[model samples]
Target: MVLFQEGLRIKMKDLQNTLEDYEQVKLSCDHTAEYIKVQSNNTEKQIKEDFEKLHQFLRDEEAARISALWKEEGQKSRMMKEKIEQMVREISSLSDSIRVVKEKMGADDVSLLQNYKSTLERAQCALQNPERVSGALINVAKHLGNLKFRVWEKM
Candidate 1:
């Protein structure tokens, strides 16, 4: 019976030590969990801030592109208008020459005939020589190639 009591006392001590060790382990686990949670929160906050900065940069870039497009469009429009006006003036001058030639059809004026021939040549040359205007254009294929890479690098 005395040997059995000593064994029981040893088992109780072992149980007490186990309980204390378990509490210490649990405390350590809780601390680690809290630390992970704080780190996760910080990482989340940083990602959100980076995302906001990227969003703002994209917005500003879009605005700048739109503004530049508008300015280019206005410039092209003005150029087209000027070209049309010049064409109208040329047509008017040609029409006047045609009328004068028709009036001089029966007249035996050598100087008038030469003038009409010169005017006719001028009109033919103007018709043959057309002005070509190449307007502004966006290259989507080229831009898309570097777009993803540029954004990723920025991040």
Candidate 2:
């Protein structure tokens, strides 16, 4: 159980860092959305950069946790179960925020953001079953990558 506990600690630290990145990205998005409302082109580019950074951070964090889970516990631990649940909740909240931001951005950018929002939601739901986390993470990563592409295209 010592290894499991150590793994859990590492996972928890990664999760905390991921959550921090998400929060920072959300804040940047909020600020950029407001700037966009006033038609600030310069701020738009900065916002896109922020989003990309957030995506990279999340991808790295997810990959680390997934690798650790697969190697150490194979997703059988109760701690892993709880961590998944927590991650789901965090992702769900982030998705909701993204949706709101999309709505504010209007119809042109709405589709891509909405797609990302839904993908995150799906990832959140997939956490309940360990077998699904890998697939869900792939989907989420794809969506986030697409989101970065779309945002950059706009800039």
- The 0-to-1 C-alpha lDDT of every candidate, in the order given, reads 0.75, 0.67
Model 1 TM-score is: 0.67
| lDDT for 63 (candidate 1) | 75
| lDDT, candidate 2, 28-115, per-residue tens | 9999899787777667888999999878876876676567556555434555577689778877776776676555456565665666
Model 1, range 56-136, lDDT digits (tens) per residue? Answer: 988876676567667766777788888889888877877876776566665667865767776456545345455666653
Q: 150, model 1: CA deviation in Å?
A: 6.5
The per-candidate count of clashes, in order, stands at: 0, 0
* Top TM-score hit: 1
Which stretches of candidate 2 lie above 4 Å from their native place?
A: 40-155
Question: For model 2, what is the error of residue 53's alpha carbon versus the real structure, in angstroms, after optimal superposition?
Answer: 44
Q: TM-scores for all candidates?
A: 0.67, 0.25
Worst 10 residues of 2 by lDDT: 130-139
